[model samples]
Target: MSGTAEDATDATTKRQRRGNTRQRIQDVALELFAEQGYEKTSLREIAERLDVTKAALYYHFKTKEDILVGLSQDLQRPIDELIEWAGTQPRTLDTKREILRRYSVALADVAPLFRFMQENQAAVRELSVGESFKDRMIRLIDTIKEPDAALTDQVRCTSALFTMHAGMFALRDVEGDPEEKRQAVLEVAIDLVTQAHAGAQSPGKPPKSS
Candidate 1:
């Protein structure tokens, strides 16, 4: 029994070590993809950066696209959870605000991935992850916007989502604390959603006389 227990512990340790190595590969690959364009980066370059043999890297990931897909899967998990949670909640102003706040947090967590996506737009679009992300955004927008909202109000709700994204990239070079910038961006997004919600709640005004 003791020998069996020891073998189980050893197996667990090996799995943990493998998980760490896979994560290291993913991190190094993302950095390389960001430094040079994704197309310019090679699996050998990623292995060289990690001081690992190509075979070792291959054990975790077979190609550059596999690395990217893995990264996207990790990043998408939180957003997927958020979308699922939002679907079960009441579509009130408070719920919308909370969604933006949570999304802001999610964005901050994946800032590096976002930066890579921004710099590699064409590559991202060509990948399946890009389409998956777009569908997720549409679901999120539905949670915040009224189905019958006016065109302008709908724009406001949609803009709220983009505002958070744009803020991350726009403020990259600006001087300030990272958390502070995130809060500021969240504030703007909340304001836009609030405005759209208010407009939806109010009755339409009569046309003015000529």
Candidate 2:
């Protein structure tokens, strides 16, 4: 193999190793957070759980909140990418539908984190979880909502996003397969956006002229 090819392979391997370690830290930290409360879980405890020294744990995450924030940011990256991609596309029904589709898939992987946030609302609030998630939602709404959309149509767009977010935890008590529930939620969310888009394109009430 060429020297450049070898270097590329080596870089890929190193990145994979780093990703694996980071995910391991997140997994161990989340486990500790659940077993005990996030407030009770310490950096030392996380280090002990991972069988690593505090210094090693600190290398990846400095505090419990940092670990939580890191996990949140890791989950946010794909959604951010989706928003960026959607922004470039023409604001059409097809583009909006694809956006909802991708967003649903992205949220599916964060079910555990979503539960953690729900169970530890105080801790999550302190970390500004709502602000970060809300900011992303606003960006996504902008991508779907037309400039002259009616108030009700805008509500539909916002509701569609919230439905997907809430589906992760809200549907937990409903007895059925997990993936099936997710599909059902996705269908509802898509239907919402589809209805909103159709309404926006349709001619509504004309202005009242004197």
lDDT winner among the candidates? 1
Stretches off by above 4 angstroms in model 1 are 206-210
**Residue 111's C-alpha lDDT in candidate 2?**
75
Residue range 1-210, candidate 1, lDDT tens digits: 999999999999999999999889999989988899899999999999999999999898998888888998876898888889998999899999999999899889999999898888898888888888888889889989999887778998999999999999999999999999999999999988888888788748522222
Measured with C-alpha atoms, the lDDT of residue 122 in candidate 1 is: 93
What C-alpha lDDT do the candidate models reach, one value each? 0.89, 0.83
Clashes of 1: 0
